[model samples]
Target chain A: AQSVTQPDIHITVSEGASLELRCNYSYGATPYLFWYVQSPGQGLQLLLKYFSGDTLVQGIKGFEAEFKRSQSSFNLRKPSVHWSDAAEYFCAVGALSNTGKLIFGQGTTLQVKP
Target chain B: VTQSSRYLVKRTGEKVFLECVQDMDHENMFWYRQDPGMGLKLIYYSVGAGITDKGEVPNGYNVSRSTTEDFPLRLELAAPSQTSVYFCASSSDRNTEAFFGQGTRLTVV
Candidate 1:
């Protein structure tokens, strides 16, 4: 069984400020990792994913995450966040054994203040 | 030039719900669930990651699915085990992650 723990429930940052959302996972083997975003009333959207190779994986909307084997963490970071960047972010673990079933974290609600 | 089919490769945004395609596709039903009405909940399944379920509750399948139930990726009587007293039981759809009607919304006061 796999699960994700997102320490932060909600985050607030200035529009131009940098942002970092932490994520930790529990898995038997090296698992597939992903980050997704959701607006006020919408579906979950993929921001980035880490499957293999390159500890650091870049994704859409200038977002990126690093897979740290030692820490068992894949944290999402952005140099500067835009107003639209404010949304709910989730960390997911996609197990190889399971085709595409992702175990998701509770989710962090990001608030970008202008 | 290639003519677009009824199926549009509609590029929406970074917010894409793409059930990723893998080369060695050994499907074990990969479902990404989302609550329908109020809050987001586990309301969808992917009998096979690539195959969209058929019509209504339709198990419409695609050709890319592999057969290997030995994986034993079955969903039977799972429990979130929240303090919420109400218990709701309903069959789920392993189809598109976006479309699902009749969802259960349980809130604990």
Candidate 2:
């Protein structure tokens, strides 16, 4: 069984401020990690994913994540966030054995403060 | 492109249905289970995730998702446990990420 955990339930940041979202996963072997965003009354959108090779993976909208094998963490970071960045963010881990099922985190809601 | 409209929240012991249509002719269609304080759980996934397969969950549900463009999940007998937000997703390739539906919130008594 694989699982993902996002410690923060909600985070508020001012516009133009840097942002960091924490994510941790529990898996037996090497895990496939992904970050997704969901706007209010909207579907989930892919932010980024990490499979192999580089520890740091870049994603759309100037967002990036660093995969730390030792920490069992893949944290999403952005140098600056806009008001439009406010949304529900989810962290997911893919199954390697079969089905390619994605186990997601509890989700962190970002609130941009003006 | 993928778009899902908000469905009227249904109660328990009622029949629940949701349809997702994809214009891109995606090969993969998936249903994810989500609850408050819990993230999305893979319930039924078909197509590019290496064949059609459903995950470990409560039964009494039927899905005929043979077509790549249209996929629907039907709950013949909904229960209290089935009260959760359901999302449908589609992806063109197995390696790429999927686009998700807006999600339908179902409340079962």
Candidate 3:
């Protein structure tokens, strides 16, 4: 079965500091990976996705993710974190058979400290 | 106005309805839409009007796609465990990114 795992449950970083959130996925074939961010009491917003192509993918809000086939990981990164950047992040694996069907990771809550 | 934004309260054992509508002319619609609690689990999804599929967790829930614009989820017996935020999303096709609604927070007591 295809699944996603976010190892960090909560992470705190100082404003302007670099950030990296780890994500690992389990799938039998080439995977379609995605990263989503959710503000408090709001719906999720797509940050980035990796379908096929370059390993490094850029997304909205200055976010970027790298898909490493060898490790089965699609980790999200941002050079500088802002106060407004704090949000819950989720990594997901899209089922190849079912286009939109996704298996999501538990989630990592990011807190920005000044 | 935020899409699919609402707060609902229902008593246990009561039948509950959660409605979602999209104006984007999307071909796919999903329910139990996003992450809350354990993570976002798909309860049901529809490829098109009158074409729906059960997802990861579908027991005690029923869904219908009445039209291209509407897809509603029905909880046969509302339970406290059912208290969670529900999201709705739609996408143009298999390869395209999906658009999400603000979400509906449902509390069953």
Top-lDDT candidate index: 3
Positional deviation of residue B17's Cα in model 1 after best superposition, in angstroms: 22
Tens digit of per-residue lDDT, candidate 2, span A1-114: 577899999999999999999999999988889999998877888999998999999999999999999999999999999999999999988776544567889999999999
- Tell me each candidate's TM-score: 0.59, 0.88, 0.95
DockQ values of all predictions = 0.09, 0.64, 0.64
Candidate 1 lDDT for residue B15? 20
For each prediction, how big is the interface RMSD?
7.1, 1.7, 1.3
Model 1 misplaced stretches (Cα beyond 4 Å): B1-44, B48-109
Model 3 chain B: ten consecutive residues of lowest lDDT = B30-39
Residue B2: error of model 1 in Å? 25
Over B1-109, each residue of candidate 1 has an lDDT whose tens digit, in order, gives 0111112122222121222232333343332334322123232334543443321121211222333221111222223322111111111221112211221222212
Give candidate 3's TM-score: 0.95
User: What would the DockQ be for model 3?
Assistant: 0.64
Candidate 1's C-alpha lDDT? 0.54
Question: What is the C-alpha lDDT profile of model 3 across A1-114, one tens digit per residue?
Answer: 888999999999999999999999999998888899999988889999888999999999999999999998999999999999999999988876765777789999999999
Quote the TM-score that chain A achieves in each candidate. Answer: 0.96, 0.97, 0.97
Q: What tens digits encode model 1's per-residue C-alpha lDDT throughout A1-114?
A: 577889998899999999999999999998788887877544456688887899999999999999999999999999999999988898877644433455678788899999
Judged by DockQ cut-offs, the docking class of candidate 3 is medium
Q: After superposition, how far is residue A69 of candidate 3 from its true place, in Å?
A: 0.3
Q: Could you give the TM-score of chain B for each candidate, in order?
A: 0.20, 0.84, 0.90
Arranged by DockQ, best first: 3, 2, 1
